[model samples]
Target: MGADLYRDGVARLEAGDGREATRLLEAALREAPGDVKVMHALSRALDAAGERERSVQLLELVHAKAPSEPEPACELAMALLERTEDTRAAEVLAPVLAAQPDHPGANLCMAMALAKTDPERAKAHLKPASRSADADQRAQAAALERVLSGQSPG
Candidate 1:
């Protein structure tokens, strides 16, 4: 039941029906309390619904519950970065980066977090991210690379 709701919620979110996604995801969370997958999906739905604070809070819980899991850590760090919480994003990303330096998403988030304070470190992370199978990650890495090199991100 919870899994079905979770899937439907994620599908709705992907379809850009944020409100419905949030509703379904919330119900899914209730049905499967403390389910990290449901929590993560709900966080995305909340963010899409403009409930940034709630989204970040849920992501924080997801990360805390599964710190060793790269996906949650990367997702939380990305959320923190969106809030301009670079320090906390970097802190949250530490273990994931340490564990999987080659993980595209982790490296990308780490690069963004360190871009302002440590361009060199950011560049190091970007190296791996630039080679990611995901085109978006590769493009973002390229853009950040341009920014770090004092060129406009065009």
Candidate 2:
């Protein structure tokens, strides 16, 4: 019912219109509180808008609601790492990787999660990430390789 607006909001978020997405998603959430998809999309919108902490909260709730789904786990893990909560990120991502090893985005994210604590191992995973068919995965893997080669990832 109300999810139509939420889905539209998600499309807006993906299109980089975070402000409009937030307004629409918030309106949807008000009507359909705790809808997992709505929460996930709105959380991503919040992250794109630079409201990182709030984004994490929305994603955490999503994870709680959908334990078997990997996207929210990936989102929360990256958000945690961005906030310097690497240990927590590892805790969340471990099961995800165990369940879906070939998920390119998850593997790339795992490599990033390991980069600060274990450079050599991260490089090994980053190699596969670079070869992944997904462009985003390849880009992340290449960025990691650049850093490992002693160049700035920037």
Candidate 3:
């Protein structure tokens, strides 16, 4: 039951129906309380629904519960970066970056967090991210690199 709801909720979220996704994911969470995966999905749904604060809160909870997990840490760090909490985001991402220096997502988040204050470090991280298998990650790294080099991303 919980797994079904979780899949359905994620499907709805992917379908661009954040409100419905949130509803379904909320029910899924209730059915499987303390499930970090459900919590992560709900966080994404909440963010998609424009409930940014709630989404960050949920991400924080997920990070706390799964501190050593790269996914949750990266998600929470990205959320913090969106809020301009660069230092905190870097702190959150430190362990993951340490464990997997070439992790595309972690490097991207770290690059974003350090871009303003430390362009050199940001560029260093971007080097690995630019070679990511994920096109979007590579694009973002390229864009950030352009910005750092004083060229417009366009």
Candidate 4:
């Protein structure tokens, strides 16, 4: 029931209905409380609403609630990255990559974070991302793949 509402919120968010998505996601969160997926949606809605701090808070809650789940960790890393907190992003994504060596987003994110300060480490993290089975990986893998090929990532 609550999950359905959250799913609808996600659909709405993807459809560009940011306001409705936020409302629906909030309603779902009220019902499900600590549900990871709902929290994820709420974070996204808040971020899309330009409430970056609130989104970060929500995702931190998700991270606290599901320490072993890579999705929230990855999202948190992304949020931190947006803030240009590259070191923190690297810290958050490192363990995720260690746990799932082939995780597309984690690998790409970690690589992206490491790129500026340490190009070699960035290349190391990005190797698997280029070959990831996930389609989202392709877009992210662009710079990394180029970097690993001795070309400029940017």
Off by over 4 Å in 2: 149-154
Which ranking of candidates, highest lDDT first? Answer: 3, 1, 4, 2
Judged by whole-model lDDT over C-alpha atoms, candidate 4 comes out at: 0.83
Backbone clashes in model 2, listed as residue pairs: none
Taking every candidate in turn, the Cα RMSD to the unseen true structure, in Å, is 1.4, 2.6, 1.6, 2.3
In candidate 3, how many Å is residue 105 off? 1.2
Q: For model 2, how does the per-residue alpha-carbon lDDT over 1-154 read when each residue is reduced to its tens digit?
A: 5777888898898899988898889989989898888888889888888888888898888877875467888888888887888778767767777777766666777777888898787776676567779887798789888997799998
Q: Ten residues in a row with the worst lDDT in model 4? A: 139-148
Q: Lowest summed-lDDT stretch of 10 residues in model 2? A: 121-130
lDDT, residue 120, model 4: 85
Model 3, which residues run further than 4 Å from truth? Answer: none
The residue-by-residue lDDT of candidate 3 on 26-142, one tens digit each, is: 999999999999999999999999998999899889888877577878889887877799999999988888888889988998999999999999999998899899999999999
Count clashing pairs, candidate 3.
Answer: 0
Model 1, 1-154: lDDT tens per residue? 9888999999999999999999999999999999998998899899899998898899899888887567888888987888899999999998887778789989999999999999999999999999899999999999999999999999
What TM-score do all the candidates reach, one by one? 0.92, 0.80, 0.90, 0.84
Residues 1-154 of candidate 4 have per-residue lDDT tens digits of: 7988898999999998877899999999999888888998888888887788998999888877775567888889888888899999888876677778878778888887888888888877777787878877876788566866688867
Tally clashing residue pairs in candidate 2: 0
Clashing pairs for model 1 are none
The local lDDT score (0 to 100) that residue 148 gets in candidate 2 is 78
Tell me the RMSD of model 4 versus the true structure: 2.3
Q: What TM value does model 2 have?
A: 0.80
Regions more than 4 Å wrong, model 1: none
